[model samples]
Target: MQKSLHITPDKCTGCLQCEMACSYENYQVFNTSLSRIKVFDFHHTGKKVPYTCTQCDEAWCLHACPVEAITMDKTNGVKVVSEDTCVGCKVCTIACPFGTVNYVQETGKVQKCDLCGGDPACATACPTGAITFIDSNWTGLDKMKQWAEKLSNQAHA
Candidate 1:
């Protein structure tokens, strides 16, 4: 049963708990700037969307790495970067369309979400249930259920 991070942007309160948790889990710090998962704030629309590596099947980062540093975790399909193998060329960063993969000056290596080795700290720390670890096959089911509930309510009214 492969699982993935399921984000509900509408439910995100912009509290940045996810960012803190991510940084703490990976870096032993509570800095948002060091966090792998970034929460994008759309102030005008009051929408806070947390974005990170989606662990694409055909990951550009993995393909762009010259040192063969990036590899897919077969267990959960997460793209993981090998710090020892990474040359810090930043080709993977440029190739990543979402800008999720990032370089760390301290380590001279790129980092991204590896789903916290199968139990995502961001999802665990989300206060509003905005970030969920769920079955990858049913990622869209929550949205479908939400729309169905709205339709049923409208019909009743």
Candidate 2:
């Protein structure tokens, strides 16, 4: 059962607790800029959506690495970067479509979510339960159920 983080944008409160937790866990600081997970705020609509690496099964970052610095962790299904092996090529950063993988100037290395080794701090820190560690296979189930309910209501009407 592979695990993944499910984010409900509608439930997000824009509190940035996930950002703080991610930065603190990786950098030991509260700097949101250093956080791998980012919350995009839409001022006009007052909506916020936390975004991060989806840890794709066929990860472009892993394939793009020149030195084989990025490897998949079998346990949690995450592509983790090896700092010692990384040469700061930034190729992996460019390959990622979601723009989750980023280069850090302080370390001259790329960084992204590693599921915190199975105990994701971001999901734990999300006050509104916007982020949840869940079975990867069922990620779309919630959305499907919601749409099914709407269709059922329309059928009865």
Candidate 3:
């Protein structure tokens, strides 16, 4: 019954509503820079991709935190930071391979997606169907990998 944010790059319009919603929900501000989610614009492809923490099983950030500040919610599979315990060492930032972990100068702490306590503002604010909270199995990544691998095999054969 665990759900996660699924993003479709082609459906995004670069409107940044997700960013605004996320910042406002967590920080009471509308600044995109303060948002946990980010919309990246690709000029060549004319695509806007919204990216955030995947909350992967490994959770490098949680393991990398020297102060043991990052913890995973077993029920929802979201990795969260404990601001009180975080020492602002920036080690977790470097450990995150996806570069989603960011340091906040104002708070002197690193921040990333927490799924907004199981109701993500980013998914709710997406004007298009680009971002959705769906059953984790329906993310389509496995399906895409299966088809892509077939294409790769056919090309090689």
Query: Which one wins on lDDT?
Result: 1
> What is the TM-score of each predicted model, taking all chains together?
0.91, 0.93, 0.88
Q: Candidate 3's residue-wise lDDT over 1-157, tens digit each?
A: 8888999998999999999999999999999999999999888988889999998889999999989999988888889999999989999999999999999999999999999998999999998989999998775788899999999999999
Stretches of candidate 1 above 4 Å error? 139-157
lDDT of each: 0.94, 0.93, 0.93
User: Sorted by lDDT, highest first, which candidate order results?
Assistant: 1, 3, 2
lDDT of 2 by residue, 1-157 (tens): 8889999999999999999999999889999999989999999999999999999988999999999999998877899999899989999999999999999998999998999988888999999999999988884777799999999999999
Write model 1 residue lDDT over 37-127, tens digit each, in one string: 9999897988899999999887999999999999987877889999989999999999999999999999999999999999999999999
| lDDT of predicted model 3 | 0.93
Clashing pairs in 2: none
Q: Tell me the alpha-carbon RMSD of every candidate.
A: 2.0, 1.5, 3.8
Candidate 1 residue 111 Cα shift, in angstroms, is 0.4
How does residue 4 of candidate 2 score in lDDT? Answer: 91
Worst 10 residues of 2 by lDDT: 134-143
Superposed Cα deviation of residue 141, candidate 1 (Å) = 4.4
